[model samples]
Target: MRICIVAQTFAPQEEGGAEIVARMCARELARHHEVFVLSLGMSGDRLAPTGEATGEDGTRVVRVNWHNSYLPGHKKPLVGRIEKARWHLKASVGAVSAKEIREIFAREQVDLVYAHNSARMQPALFEASRQLNIPLCVHLHDYALLCPKSSMFSAGGNCDTPCLKCRVLTSRLKSDGEGMTAIAVSEALKQTYLRAGVLTKADWHVLRNENLREDKLHRPFVGRDSARSDIFTFGYLGALSEEKGIEDLIRAFVDMPNRRSAKLIIAGRGREDYVRHLQSIADGAPVTFMGFTPPEEVYGVADAVILPSRWREPQSLILIEAAAYGVPIIATNLGGTPEIVEDMKTGWCYDPSVAGSLAGVMEKALKIGHGNWWAERDKLFPGIRGFKGTAEASRYYERLNALLVEAQRPDHLHLQAL
Candidate 1:
């Protein structure tokens, strides 16, 4: 099948986990089927190039430039917010030409359009697919359909209900339309959308994000060794945003006993103000900020990793990656995290809401000792197979395409008409 993987951003310009997952899925799909990526380009120029280029993985990528008067990449406080809002508004109304997409679909003879992180590209492509009689499947990586912020996290907790602004933004979001299928990275995320009345009319499936390739998993496990090293190292790798609980992680680390002997390494980038605030709180503590360390380097050195997310993290790829590296995890007991990290068996889970809860968990983790950590690793490493590779994930996409094709059959339509 000739598949067009649509996303807001692709690799070399990735902002988060969604892009990584999309690239991996696209490359795996390309092994068997022809794959094309439609994404936005990151440039402030008015007439930046908007055309096709071969991705690093050999897949063809078509980058579309957002040519709105409202600067798409502007970062000024009030003006930037307004520009982003205008861009999203324009995108929702199909400002990006449907004719252009139709022409591309025809030229490529695209069999299916698999959308991942289409917040920037908007629902225009979805409508175009419907008009062209092309089957479209959307993979939900975040809550962009229900919340403009996309994390469904605000102030300090998961959003239980949409606010007035959220309702307005959600109203502007285009519907999935008839015959569209929705794939959620986790069952928790699926239920969240279902309860919010988002994607209610579409078929739903849960496909966990792939964490590591089989070849990458061949490295020797790095279990904690308390005897070899006097200081225990705890690491946090990902975006340094507030919703990610980086502040909380720092606070918990500072409060841990014998923190002088233990070290906290934070490796990611976010708002400088937040980073400064974290630094202020971490003063006098053994904390090191590596800015942005690659995942391989992070897992290689850290004794354990912490995912102190305050929101309902829909299948954290870091948790699986850390586990795959034989490094234990200490994560919040929210959303799909528990599904990945079994408390006490694989890693520890703490309540993100309760004060000192994460610190308590961290203390427990520090006491696990090298011997116990290895024992847990021995048990959990075998189960890591399910989350390791993209081969199975690609097969899921293939199955989805077959199901969609069958649903579009003339006889199937006739049966449904009865």
Candidate 2:
């Protein structure tokens, strides 16, 4: 199958988990099938015009320069905001990316197009697939369809319903997601959309994200050092945004009675103001702000990982990564996290909404100690075995592609007509 993977950002851009997953899936699919990537070349303040490049894995990548109304090159914050608003307005009518995607389909004879995170490129790509009579599979990495914020998180918790601003802003866009097959990273995400009356007619599937490379499966499990029994290391890895409940985590850590013996390590980048706020809250607490540490290093040092997200995390990839490293997790009981972390068996889940819920969980984890944590790790090892690589995930995509092809066959159409 000649599959064209579409995403707003790809490797070297590294905006979030969706881009990483897109790159990994493209590379894995390239090994057995003809694969191509179509991504925007705009990263941060850099904007590269439309061009062709080869992925590290030898997959062909077509980088289309999205000349949306958003003047990404502008340095002024107000100017950038205005341009972004203009671009969103224009995108709602039809994404400027449609023409480029149509050209790629014609040039490459793409059999199917798999799109992820339709932030900059939405209705346009969907329209292109429909016009070309090619199957388009959309992967819901976030709640962009229902809410423009993408995270569906604002004012400390998940939005109960699409707000007036969201409805008005996205009014022109046809997000009904018709004529596209849908795949969500977690069951919780799928249910969220279903409950919101989005993608009602689309066939949906739940495919979890892949975290660990296949080679790492055999790597020896490095349990927490027995010598370090004097102190427990608790870690938080991912964006340091307010929506991630980073403040709550820090508050919890500071309030713990074992604050001096227990250490908190926060690894990831976020807004400067937010980072400073977190630092202020951590004053006198045994917390280290290791900005943007690699996943390997984050997993290597921590005795346990915490994901204190206030929103329904589509799927906390960190949970899977932590499990792979034989580290137990302490996450909030929200979204798809519980699906990954089997409460008590794999890790503990606490309510982030409650004032001291996360702190209580942290205290419990420290009491359980490292020895028992490692034993629980052994029990949860099988659950995380699925995170080894993208082989199984690639197969799911291949099967979906084949079924789409079969559905489009002449005989199938004739049977439907009969």
Candidate 3:
């Protein structure tokens, strides 16, 4: 069976969550079947040209030069109102895009299409899959099906429901989700889509995200000893966007009277303006901006890793890394954070909506100190360690294989298996 993973990007090019998961699935599926990736390239003109390239490690990547308003670069490329609207409209229904996908599918003779974070190609891909009668599987990494921003978040906080603009933009997405296989990375994400009435007629499954299964990736997580230093460094790993609550973390830490003893380390890249704004608002606080360093390095020195996301983030890979490194976790009790972090047991979860909530949690964490988070931390969160070998990826391959094997059988409805 030949499987094509359709995504916005692939490695060894970019390493976002979606790209990482897509590559992982490709690796696992390659063991049993032929696997490759199909992605949109930033190169080439707007004529939607296509090219093929093989990575040094022998990963096959097929890139289509399809631009939607603006090309997404190292940082999210900014788009204006008219162009943004044009892009969204095209995403909703692009006959040309559908034709292109159908031709690609025909040429490749792919048995299945696994799509992740390919928003710009949506609805068109759905039509293409239907026209070719090819099985399509969507791995949800965000609320792309419901919100045009793909982040059901705003300047305020996590949205209770999609805005009117989002409702209009994604009106047909739910119905387009029909006849496809849906993989929600978390139960929360599954429910979020269900509430939005998406994937009602699709084969739905929840596959919680997991870290890479490798020993080198799971190095001993050692919390700093209290005797070692008085300076408590709080590390914020991942995108440095405000919706991630980077500003809130800076504000909270800066306002604290005992701020002198604590330092804030933000490790990740963001838009230049946003990064400059965050730096400006830090107001001379003890915040170090380590641009796009390796996650392992950040997990090593940080006393406690904070996930101050202001949105209903599906999950945080940072949480997994922090746990693997024995660093304490502090995150807003929004979305799937609570599922990973036990309030008083493993890590701290707070409500960022309430004033001084994150600050209070930070104070408590600083007081508690990061000494033996647990005698055996792996037992504290098996989800972090359990899936740490080929276990997680193999599980994905098994389920997908089952789907491809018995998709026409009536018993295939029971695909909700773990």
Reference-based TM-score of each model: 0.86, 0.86, 0.87
Clashing pairs in 2: none
For TM-score, the strongest prediction is 3
Q: What is the lDDT of candidate 2?
A: 0.70
lDDT of each structure? Answer: 0.71, 0.70, 0.71
Better of 2 and 3 by lDDT: 3
Estimate, for each residue in 6-108, the C-alpha lDDT of model 2 and write its tens digit.
8777655545777777777777667666888887654343443458877566877777766654322112244477776776676556545677778889899
- Write model 3 residue lDDT over 1-418, tens digit each, in one string: 8888887666655577777777777777778878788877655533223578786657788876564554442444477878767776765664136677788889999888888877767667777888888877788888988897888987676788888888887776666356677878777888888887778777877666663565436344333222222477788888888788888998899888777777888899988898999889887888899998888667767777889999898877666556645566889888877877762244778888699998888887666544543333444433434333233544546665676554434345656545
RMSD of 3: 3.6
For model 1, what is the error of residue 299's alpha carbon versus the real structure, in angstroms, after optimal superposition? Answer: 0.9
lDDT of 1 by residue, 1-418 (tens): 7889997666656357787778877876777778899876535532224687786668788876654553222132345767767866665454566667778888999888888888555656766787888877788888888777787888777887677777776675657445777778887888888888777877677766753455555355433222233467788998888888999989888888867767888899877888899999999999999997777667777777899988888888887677656677888988888876773245778887788998887777667654565555556444443333333433555554455454445343311210
